[model samples]
Target: MNETIARLMNHRSVRKYTSRPVERERLETIISAAQMASSSSNVQAYTAIAVTDPQLKDKLAGLAGDQPYIRECPVFLVWCADLSRLKAAAERHASDKPSYEGAAENFVVATVDAALASQNAAVAAESLGLGIVYIGGVRNDIAAVSEALNLPDYVYPVFGMCVGYPDPEHGAGIRPRLPLETVLHMNGYSAEQSGRGVQTYDETTVRYISDRTGGRRTAPWSKLMADKLTAPSRLHMKSFLESKGFNKE
Candidate 1:
């Protein structure tokens, strides 16, 4: 495989980061690459806020489930699914009010746009010898995070990313994934084919978790997922999204 493909294959989340700051020029380059990611109809309805201030990062770390890496990383990026810009654009170009600014379909578009751009940024950062981790805990207290970030209506923080040089002493390794056949379908999907390798995958993950935890935790993938499904998740998402002027439709 080519270097790019190989790099993609070796992707892993890095939680422990060095104190070395990510230079602004390099961060800009990464964002520029992120902007090049494919967008739905070229809407590019997203914004990335790079958090550098130590106190701000600390507060964000607490908001994001107290993730230490968020504060430790040189740059913490908050990727927002932002339709506020689109709404402004519409008002500027044609009407005073946007007809479908809060449409559920547009929410999906913005969220996906943010995700795609963030992944592109991740790849770009990795290419530049930086390590990164995505923080989904930003959604744990979505309202607080939005308030902290000063997000506007029609904008929401989809996720956060911690970026910096990896701490070699505590570097993470690539984890195993489901076999290619399990995910790669010929054309139409086949549930049986997709599920055929899960048992083996569960075993593989059981071992991986054991190794990672020094044998203290050995829960299989299915069991862990089952527990997660049984737990109360972010049940406030519906109301929170509505409050932020998304998914009114």
Candidate 2:
């Protein structure tokens, strides 16, 4: 594989980090790389807030499922799917209020934009020898998180990320992914191919987890997935989105 592909394949979610602070210049460069990510229709409907204050991080860590890494890391970035800018632009250029305030498509586009930008930032940080972990637990209490961040209407904190130099003592190995055959479809699509591929992948994942966790967790991939899906999760997201002036229709 080429150098970029190799680097991308080596990604791991780093939970532990050294006390070393990421340099301001390097952080700016990483943010610039994120800004270079492609946006749907060039709307670029996203915002990233870099928080370094220890007190703020501590509060955020508490809000985000008590993830200590947020407080420990030198930088915690909150990625938000933002439509407030669009609303202002619409008011200035076209109308008194934004027309796409409650459009589901706009919400999707903003979320996609934020995700793409965050991935770009992650890749760039890794390339610079920094470790990063995405913190989706921020969504556990979306309203509280928004309030803490002072987010206005039409802006949702989709997730947060912790970035810093990895602590060698706490380094984790790369986790396995589902087989490409299961995900990549040829021509149109084939359920038989997907099913067979997933069956094999289930076995592969069992072995991987066993090896990774020293056999502490022996459940098959399918079973684990079934258990996870059986649990009610993020049930408040729909109403939360509506409250944020999204998907009102």
| TM-scores, each model vs. reference | 0.97, 0.97
Please write out the lDDT profile of model 2 over residues 138-237, one tens digit for every residue: 9998999999999999999999999999999998988888788888998979999888887988898889889988999878888988999999988988
* Runs with alpha carbons beyond 4 Å of true place in candidate 2: 96-98
What is the C-alpha lDDT profile of model 1 across 179-222, one tens digit per residue? 78888999799899877777788899999999999999998887
The TM-score of predicted model 1 comes to: 0.97
Residue pairs whose backbone atoms clash in candidate 1: none
Which segments of candidate 1 are over 4 A away from where they belong? Answer: 96-98
